[model samples]
Target: MQPETIKTQQPDLTGAAPAARLHQVAAFAGLSADQTAHLAQPSNIERSIADHMIENMVTTLAIPVGVATGLLVDGQEVMVPLAIEETSIVSFVTDSARKCRPAGGITTSMSGTVMIAQIQLVHVPDPYRTRTLILERRDEIGALCDACDPTLLRMGGGFRDIEVRIIDTAAGPMVVLHLLIDTRDAMGANTVNTMAEAVAPRLKEWTGAQPLLRILSNLADRRLARAHATWRPADIGGEAVRDAIVLAYRFADADPYRATTNNKGIMNGISAVVLATGNDTRAVEAGAHAYAARSGRYRSLSQWEVDAEGNLCGSIELPMAVGLVGGATRTHPTARVLLAITGAKTAEGLARIIAAVGLVQNFGALHALTTDGIQKGHMARHASNVAIDAGAVGEDVAQVAQEMIARRSINVETAKAILAERQSQRAD
Candidate 1:
């Protein structure tokens, strides 16, 4: 399929064009006038809802929501709405991807998503003895587990393998059964958890190993997605800059403390999309960090190297267990809209896009660290926000923001002062 194109997302201010013309485009399709207005300005309000057999429950929380503009994935133009609060996140990723767009953006590939369901079996007289029984009846047990979610089987996904581990822990010797499940497109949590519960009773009877916990493990090492991108040396010129990036990457690669911050840069973008979709961002984050240290040493989630051709090549590999069928994927209207814009039908496809976002975002940070420094480009974008917060009106917003950034004081107070000075000059 051809890639999408990026277009200016500014609302139609002029009353000249036919309204239907805008609706025909994919960008404006499937949205009501009211929803369109809501997108133009999002709100975070406290609301109450009744749960089954439960009375009035009120929740107070701030939704860190915003929009990610200028997204061009595979020639498709999408204006993504992100609900995230972490500073410098959305800006860094979007800016990096824009610079790499000329090189055909970033291309991503993913492995077939296979999430592991850990069914803990404990209090057994002999875990080693139980291991033999489970393995011997692997297919039979796997079928019993798969039968719980027939819909998944009909969709060509279900329990694929069964393995048992005899772990000697501080508490005692225990057997941990692993159900390697193929979740297909959806996040495999509910499916695997259900399967685990179904097999628990059978497992207890067969091996006499009591089932303790039947839950899905967030350490999604099996379901992995990766993305890669390359930037020409000419695009990011000078030997000094190249060396600086390589050095910075090495610092991150070698030290866990540095690597954590560097990886956080990548997650800033990935988590935004994940949050927008109503997926579990915390699970994704946990899986990523755990996967990074899977080899016994904590390191950078991304790898950076200067290729023989002198072009900068970057890649990232992370555990991404995202889904499409369950949770807020269908519940929230905005998530539904964002999913449609990406043209992703399956959960794995979304994982690939998330991987690509991380790659582009990390590149953004490394590029900044190597060249003019991380604050320059980020502060420039933030200046406008400060200006607005300082109550700069209309055209003066941009003008005053530019002056604040130029003076190296891109803060709300500086912006306010600049706006007042500009107004006084105009009055004089």
Candidate 2:
């Protein structure tokens, strides 16, 4: 017997009502009624908004948002909202910040909100000669770029300078032009990209080369943010712990494997705030990792040392290409609220806060590593999740989690056993 072929039309969800779009997607994807109904529940973001935010939107995944308290940056106490699923980060960062408060908390500085746009020219007739020609036309190129964004220019931000470099690649030699622009209050991807595109034709004509890959560079070295904080030996468990932390940092600075995890711990705090504020986490991560490897070797993004007062001092510097005026920062309601809570009046202010948070977060991880080990506190917090996963609810969840922690056995099986023992005792 021959089977009949079934022709199904692909669902056109463009401009369709949210409910209609959901139904069509559900039907096309062969979702069960229960699964479809489960996804139909009220999300933190409205379906209408989510649909417009991205393509092929089926549902919104909500992450728990919590705030770290008592983070003092540049003499101001600010509460930072962190949207992440990982446990113990908020508490650890809060504790680290409190420990630093006795020594004046975290002080931060920014290297301006400058971003770079790169124009790659290949097959140039004479690469070095083209570079010289580009330098001679710096004023013209700057004016051309400045003209791309009138609002930016009026707001005291536009083209600042131009740089030309000649490099050899596997393909051949190439001439690269770097357009430095002050992005003002924006991350400036779009602004700089437009400038690069607008100036590419002129660059190609001058160099007699083909222009390719005119875009913004994620290695935002020009937009660097730095932070430093001191912790008294008495405040951070005395000289022994402080010295151990410095040693740990030395290990990370010497090895790529350790540096990767050390950098990730820093980003755990920075990325959470970036996501909560609706900024680009990937861009920040890329820039940070690239900056770490800028010295021809991968190393820690932060430094730790012992100061003259026998206190532990920590500092961090990284490329922070985050913005306040565009993208999801303006469109997401929750992001606006988070920004208000942060009290950052400009992009530079926000970057400073993020850098400070990264420094403190790294300190917290080092403190944990040198003292009680990272998993001790981490597992204690994770016990609650295991309890919930083992079918404990409400107050029972806390009871089961506590029992598991007390027993030094944090797992689903332990949680279930604890719950079972409780039920049996209640019946008796």
* Candidate 2 residue 204 C-alpha distance from true site, Å: 1.7
Worst 10 residues of 2 by lDDT: 1-10
lDDT of 1: 0.76
Supply candidate 1's per-residue lDDT for 157.
89
Model 1: per-residue Cα lDDT over 1-428, one tens digit each: 32233344433322323343234333444566655544444442224222321355455344655444444555544444456765567666666666665555677778778888888887888878789999999989878877888888999988878778888988899899999999987887888998888888988888888899999888887888888877666656756666777788899989999999998888888888898876889999999999889889888999878888776778889999999887667655556665764557789878888888888778778888877887888788778878989998888988988899789999988988899899899999
Which ranges in model 1 have alpha carbons more than 4 Å from their true place? 1-81, 86-88, 102-104, 388-400, 419-428
TM-score for all models, in order of appearance: 0.84, 0.89
Alpha-carbon local distance difference test for all models: 0.76, 0.87
* Number of the predicted model whose TM-score against the real structure is largest: 2
Name the best candidate (by lDDT).
Answer: 2
For candidate 1, report its TM-score: 0.84
